[model samples]
Target: MKTIKSNFNAQGLVRIDSDDLKLEIKFESSQIYLNVISVNPRNLKTFFNLSDLRKLVIDVADKLAFWKFDLTVTWEGDELAYLGQHANPNILQKFIVAKNVEIKNLKGFAKLLGGRST
Candidate 1:
């Protein structure tokens, strides 16, 4: 996991890039916006299977916990375009909530919760 850039203070943005993923998060007055691109063996264009997608969301929710703020996630690249075709906003909220609960249950997790700027 490598941080490309980060500004995690109020109304900030963070970008992290790794071999398998590229994640960008922006904090605003009313919400937190997340943009994710999954790079995997199957597809270079950010294709995500169900398992991968779930894991991505869980990891994100765990690392960045801001329950008070509304969350918005944009799945980037061509493979995830299907989600937009069948969009249901509630699904994302439920998934995030569920993942947040899972994270809370595991003690001593997210040692580097809010990432440092580079």
Candidate 2:
């Protein structure tokens, strides 16, 4: 894994590139935005397999465990294919689970967290 760039000031950002994936983590106010993209050449014609997708999510979740910020994951390209045509909430739930971290409904924290998109 390689960190392409990082800034931890207010409204910070971090970009990591590894294998065929890119993780862009941005901190804005009370929330954290995690954008995961597949950089594999083959992804142009195919979606990420379940194993790779799961690993990506778990890896990101683990890395962000130290932050108390609410997280919003934006799916793109082949990643969206894995999420299905409608962005299945159930599958998304599985991906966002981190060891010892509580995943809560965005509705409950929307006001306090500044209404970040889920």
Candidate 3:
């Protein structure tokens, strides 16, 4: 695995920056896998196939199964923020298994102790 020199500030936020963009990913626990993404609003179709994992896809699925859902995420904002709609307590535990990402509660820990996004 390749190692990236990254740091989490006192507030516990992981900031990632590259040539094209800058983004922040906050972990409630300590898992590297997340369920959110941002795509070109006008051409999401073009970016849709870029990856098989979509964090909102996972979070929404989780919300569908259970009325209330606890989650962990890492992705661009605004685009993925709408997922809050699924956070209702009435539908949180409906799905036991889902094909998409896994929902984890980070609770304030960090994952990927020394690795970069794959």
Sliding window of 10 residues with minimal summed lDDT for model 3? 106-115
Provide the TM-score for each candidate, comma-separated.
0.38, 0.36, 0.28
Top lDDT hit: 2
lDDT, candidate 1, 1-118, per-residue tens? 9545343445889998988668887878646666775434335324655567557765555445432334555553222211111223345545653434222211111111221324
lDDT of 2 by residue, 1-118 (tens): 9655343435889998988668897878646766765455454225655457556656655555433334665545222211211223455565554352334444532322233455
Error of 1 at 48 (Å): 13
Runs in model 3 lying further than 4 Å from the true structure: 1-11, 28-56, 59-79, 82-86, 89-118
Kindly indicate the candidate among 1 and 2 with the higher TM-score. Answer: 1
Evaluated at residue 99, the lDDT of candidate 2 is 51
| For every candidate, C-alpha RMSD to the true structure in Å | 13.8, 12.3, 13.5
Write the candidate numbers in order of decreasing TM-score. 1, 2, 3
